[model samples]
Structures are given as C-alpha cells and as structure tokens.
Target: MSLSLRPARRDDAALILAFVRELADYEKLRHEVEAELADIERDLFGSNPRVFCDIAEWDGAPAGFALWFYNYSTFRGRHGIFLEDIFVRPAFRSRGIATALMRALAQRCVTEKLGRFEWNVLDWNAPAIRFYRSVGAIPLDAWTTQRVDGEALERLAAG
Candidate 1:
C-alpha cells in the first residue's frame, strides 16, 4: 500500500470540491457548503491563489486531500497555516492517509519556519478528537470560535 502526498494540480479542482462536500457531510454541515466547482478551480488555480491543497494517493489512486492556507498571527508577528479541510474516503480509512497528510503539513511548517498549524474539528467527533490527540494536538478549550457571515456579514460591511 504505497501512500504518497503531492501538491494539488490544476486538474484536481473537481476532486478537491468533492472532498470538501464529503467532509462537510461528515461534519453535518453540508447545508453550509456554498462552494461550486468553478469556485474551487478559480480560487485554487487562479492567478495569485492564496489557498492550496495537497492530494494523497494510495497506489497511484487519489484517496484523500488536505486544503490549507496561510494566516497571520498578530501576536506572533508571523504567519501560520490554517488547515481548511482534511478528508479521506471511507474506503481509504485506517490507511494512514490522514496522518500522512498532517505530517506533510507539519513538515511544511517546520521547513518554512511558520509559527503554527491549526484546524477546527467538530466537538462531537470523538474519533476525530482521539486522532488529533494522538497527534499531540491540544484542545483550546479557553477559546471559542466566532463567525459572522450571510446577513450578519452584509450588515457588518454596510456599517
């Protein structure tokens, strides 16, 4: 079972979108996904692209992916990685695809001297929580996530 990780190619837009939807479904947040294929292609492959994705393959067949981007840390005075999405198909579970993807990103952080690597997981995802804990990840229980979007986002903009 040869598993490898590679940077996503322009042709991987569809695969990336599929993974996004699948992950959203898993998190029970499918209704919040407003992304389209064109959005994936344009945002990931367009000029001056800010976000990026890494594809994981098992024996030359795509099995999973990790999408991430750089985020600024005002206190740290440096940039860090924010993993937007990570997913592996049901058939690919227990194959270390997820671990490999995480390792690759962590390696990137080390190599680039990035300040940190971060991602959010649903609180009720026990399995995911266990996996993350096994990876030496800590839960920031003191911090609460906040979001302002849709009508609230529009109102904020107008104000």
Candidate 2:
C-alpha cells in the first residue's frame, strides 16, 4: 500500500482536526472534543510549539496521525514522549499503519535518549489493548489516571 510517515505541516491542521473528530467518534467521546482548527494551528504550528504531530500517508493519501509532546519524569530525571493521540482511519486499520507510527515514535525515543514512551488506552478498548500488548507495551495497571478539567481546572488555576 506504500505507506509513509512524515512530520505534519501547518497546512495539515484541518486534516488533523478531522482525524481527531473521527477518533473521538469512534471512542464515543465526540461530545467532549472542544478543539478547534485555530487551537490546532496555534498549538502545533506556533513559534514555539508544545505539541507535534506525524502524519501517515498511504499511497499519497492521508491515513492516520500521531500527536505527542515531551513530558518530564521527575523520578526518571529525564524527558519522555507522552503520546496524546494516535488514530488511523477505519479503512486503514490492521495494515500496520498504527504500528509504523508507534515504531517511529519508539525510534525517536531511542535516538533522543528519552526515559520513556507512554500513552493511555481506555480499559474497554480490548482490541487496542491487545495490539499494544502484542507490540511489547506493558500496562501500568496500578496507576489510576486522574484529571481535572473544565470548571474544576479553571477553579484550580484561580487558586
């Protein structure tokens, strides 16, 4: 299928947003997607970008993307790549596109001497979990993820 991966460009913001919506819909979290094209552009293509995205193309067409950012691990005393999202269109699944994306990220970790490469998957996503496990990803089962967003996040910032 001639798949290739490349760093996303500023012109790809709309496509990336479309992929985000598709992924949210698949995960049944469409209602929670508050991201807009402007946000994507500013965050990913600004003068000092905090996030980055890699696009996967199959036969010169958009197939998927992986969005990530650097995160610090105080215990490890180094930076790691925190994968914010990885999504492949349904028609492109099971074609090693996702694996290729992950492999590229792992390569980055190795080259950059990063302490870890990690991401979270929903508990109910058995297929995704299986794919991750097959790729030698270990689950941090003991760690429960917690987040404060929306009004709570604003309140915390105000304090």
Candidate 3:
C-alpha cells in the first residue's frame, strides 16, 4: 500500500467536499454540513485562502484528508496551525494514514516555526483519542469548547 500526501488543488473541490461529507457522516453530523462545492472552492482556492487542505492517497486512490488553517495564541505570541478536520475512510483506518496526515502537519509547524498544532476530537471518540495520545497529543481537559452558529450566529452578529 503506497501512501502519499499532497496539497489540495483547485480542481479537488468535489473530492474535498466528498471527504467532508463522509467525515460528517462518521461524526454523525451530516445534517449540519451545509457547505457546497462552490464554498469549498472559494475558501480553499481563492486568491487569499483562509484555509488549506491536504489529500492523502493510498495506492493512488483518495484515502483521507486534513483541513486546517492558521490561528494565533496570545500567550504563545506566535501563530499555530488549527486542524479543522482530519478524516480517513473506514476501509483505510488503522493503516497509519491518519498518522501520516498529522505528521505532515506537524512537519509544517516545525518548518514554519509555528507555535503549536492543535485540533478537537469528540469525547466519545476513544479510538481517536488513543491514536492522538500515542502521537504525544495531550488533551486540554481544563478547557471547554464553545460555539455559536446558524440562526444564533446571525442574531449575535446583528446584535
């Protein structure tokens, strides 16, 4: 099984979208996926992209992807990479694909001198948690994640 990682290209919009939906399905959040291919193309291939993606292929076929963006940490006083999503197809899991994808991001952090590489995983995802721990990722259990979206997000903005 030959595995390789490559930065996502403009023509990969549909593939990326498919991966996103597949991931959403795995996370049981498919109903929340409102993003369209145009949105993905605009955000990822736009002149000034705010987000980026990397595609992982196993034997020349799409196997997984990692989507991320730059974030800042006031205390660290430097930029860090925030991984929005990392997903490997079910058939491709446990094949080191996710590790490779993460390692690629970690390498970017080292090469760019970024402060940190971070991401969120659901509490119920024990397997993912174990995999993350094996890679030396420690959960910030002291912190809780918060979000405002959909109608509430619009109302908050209007306020």
Candidate 4:
C-alpha cells in the first residue's frame, strides 16, 4: 500500500474524530469519550494549539493518524514527543502503517533532538504491547501510570 503522511488540516476534524471513536471503541472505553470534532479542531489548529497531528493516507484514503505533543522532561533537561494517540483502522492494519507512523515520530525526535518518544498502552492490549516490543520499546515494569481525570482534574486545577 502506498502511504502518504502530512500535517492534518482543520477540514480533517471529522475524519479524525471518527478514527478516535473507533479507537475508543476498540479499547472498550467509548463511554469516556466526551470530546467532539470541534474540540480536536480547536486544540490542534487554534492560535494556541496544544498538539499537532500527521495524517496517514493509504491507497489514497485516510488510514490513520499520529497525534502528538511536546513534553518537557525536567530530569532529561530537554523536550520530547508524547504520542497521545496513534490509530490505524483494523481494515488497514498489518500494513506497516502503524510502524511507519512511529518511524516518522522517531525521525522527528532525532531531527529535532528531542530526548525521547513516549506513550502508554493498555495493559490488556497484547497486540499493541507486542508491536511496541518489536519496535524496540521496553516496558517500564517498575513504573505504574497514574492519572487524575474528569472532575478530579477540574478540582485540582481550581485549587
């Protein structure tokens, strides 16, 4: 499959949202998705954009996307790319699209001297875990991911 990757445009919000819902469903967390296409458009293309994305097209059709953001690591004393999401529809899986997207993200790290690229995978997602292993990513077994979400996030921010 011929794949092309480029920065996503505002017009692609609907497509991006569709893919995001697909991912949420696949992960069995569809109910947690309260976001909309307008949210994506604003965060990705607004004056103070919080993130950037690159869409992947396979055979002239939207196949997947890589949404990422810059993160500062105080210990590392540098910036890194935090991969918020990378999803390729199942119909287009096993076509190296995901790998290609990761390669592009890594290349950006190297080109920009970003310290590292990081992301979290669901513990039950063996397939994704295997893929990350194949890509030479080592799991941080000693570290557990922690998060404050929803109302807790709001409460914390208000304090």
**Candidate 1 on 74-143: residue-level lDDT in tens?**
8888899999898999999988899999999999999998898999988899998898988889999999
What CA RMSD would you report for each candidate?
0.9, 1.0, 1.1, 1.4
Q: Estimate TM-scores for all models.
A: 0.97, 0.96, 0.96, 0.94
lDDT of 2 by residue, 1-159 (tens): 699999999999999999999999989999999999999999999999999999999999999999999999999999999999999998888999999999999999999999999999999999989999978999998999999998999999999
Two-way TM-score contest, 2 vs 4, winner: 2
Cα error, candidate 3, residue 151 (Å) = 3.2
lDDT (10s digit) by residue, model 4, range 68-102? 99999998899999998889988899999999999
Q: What lDDT does each candidate get?
A: 0.93, 0.96, 0.95, 0.92
Stretches off by above 4 angstroms in model 1 are none
Question: Candidate 2: lDDT of 90?
Answer: 89
Q: Model 4, poorest ten-residue lDDT window? A: 41-50
What is the model-wide C-alpha lDDT for candidate 1? 0.93
